[model samples]
Target: MTIQVGDRLPEAKLQRIRDGVEVVDTPTLFEGKRVVLFAVPGAFTPTCSERHLPGFVEHFDEFRDKGVEVLCMSVNDPFVMKAWGESQHVPDGLMMLADGNGDFSRALGLEMDASGYGMGKRSKRFSLYAEDGVVKQLNVEAPGEFRVSSAEHILSQLP
Candidate 1:
């Protein structure tokens, strides 16, 4: 079963590019915080690059102002995530996390098989709001759909 609302997020390794350096096993990055984490299939794909990620990047300040930290995750490597963030002009507060091996995505039961597209395994499109490591809400999009997990949807549901 997929991860559900109110479940504590499972601890897993995460790869991130910090200050031009590669780092790993950064699950504690969200510990003791209220966080909104969204996962996409890949870094430079059409819908994700054009719409999904931009929505989060655009609304990042509002989320932060509401005392929530926002993170964007994908199955791509940290270098791709960092380059994508830079090319997209992502702001400072929005963190781009890499689930390179899909360990974290699998832990959440959100891994997708994109082998048909030659992308191998990747993450499904989804979003979660967590408080101190426990999930408060989760929005999982249907395959190839993008409506439920957008930034606007999450913001509208926020208290």
Candidate 2:
């Protein structure tokens, strides 16, 4: 089943790049925080590189002031995620997490088959708001659509 508002977030290990190295499990990062977690299909894909990530980067301070820790996830490995985060100059408030084996994506029921694009299985574009590990809200886009999960949309839903 798809994750929904009010559900406790699934517990899954994620690889985060810390000090230029890949670190594992790291779920404690969100244990006592209000987090806005958004996922994209891949690291450097057109929409993700130009639009999706920049939206979060540009709104980093606003999210922080609103007590939301922003996290971006993708199916890429930790090295790719690290490179992409550095390339984008991601702000400290924003975390770039690697769902390398798609365990987290699959757990959220957000995995998509993109084999035709040669990308194999990947994540659908989506965003969620969590408070101390329980989901507060969720915004999921229809396939090929981008309107619902943008920063603006998420901001509008913030209390």
Candidate 3:
């Protein structure tokens, strides 16, 4: 089953690129924080690039003002994640994370089979609000839908 509110995130290695690629364990990222974590199917795909990511970038300050860290994750490599963030010009505020081998996505039961699309194992689109490692709210989008997981939606739900 997919993870839910009150569940602590499972342990898995996730990557972020700074001066160099850095690997951070899931617990370290979630511990002692309120995080707005969103996942996309792929980095450069149309909806992901055009709509999904920009939503977070546009409202990042609001999340920060509420003391929530914003994380954008995909199954791509750290290099690609970093490049994408830089291309969007918000590398400083958004935490672009890579799940490299889909270990974290599988553990969360949010892995998607896109072999027919030739994308192989990828993450489904979703977003969650986690506080100190335990989820407080989660929005898992229906396939090909972007309605409930947008930044505005999360912002509206924040306390």
Candidate 4:
């Protein structure tokens, strides 16, 4: 089943490249923190690069002002995600997380089959507001839709 608004996110490790590649355990990352996590189907895709990530980057300050940690996750490996971040000029406050094996997305029931597009198991576009690891609000887009998961939309839903 897909994760719901009241569910606590599962404990799974996602990767990021700061100094070098490192694993960030999901539960610990969100524990005792206000977080806004958004996922895209893949990194460097047209919509993802142009609208999805930029929306979050543009609204990052508003999220932080509300004490929310913003995160962008994709099914790509840490290397691609890191490179995409550098290309997009993503800010320090927005975390770029790599769900390399789709374990985290699978655990959350958010993994999608993108084999038709030559991408394997990827995540659907979605955004959620979680506090202390428990989801307070979730906006999961229908495949190919992009409205509700944007940072602007999430910011309007913030508590």
**Which candidate leads in TM-score?**
4
lDDT of 1 by residue, 15-87 (tens): 7777665565535766788889999999999999999999998888899999999999999889999999998
Which model, 1 or 2, shows the larger lDDT?
Answer: 1
lDDT of 4 by residue, 8-80 (tens): 9999999999889998899778999999999999999999999999999888889988999999999999999
TM-score per candidate, in order? 0.95, 0.95, 0.97, 0.98
Query: For model 2, how does the per-residue alpha-carbon lDDT over 1-159 read when each residue is reduced to its tens digit?
Result: 888888888888888878666565535766788899999999999889998899999988999889889989999998999899999999876889999889999999899999999999999999988888888989988988888889888988998
* True lDDT of residue 3, candidate 1: 90
lDDT of each: 0.89, 0.88, 0.92, 0.94
RMSD of 3: 0.8
Indicate the residue-level lDDT of 104 in model 4. Answer: 92
* Residue runs of model 4 more than 4 Å from their true location after superposition: none
Shift of residue 31 alpha carbon in model 2, Å: 2.1
Off by over 4 Å in 2: 20-26
Candidates 1 and 2 compared by TM-score, better number: 1
Q: How many pairs collide in each candidate, listed in order? A: 0, 0, 0, 0
Count: clashes, candidate 4: 0
Model 1: worst 10 consecutive residues (lDDT sum) = 21-30
* lDDT score at residue 70, model 3, on the 0-100 scale: 93
Q: CA lDDT of 121 in candidate 1?
A: 93
For candidate 3, list the clashing residue pairs, or say none.
none
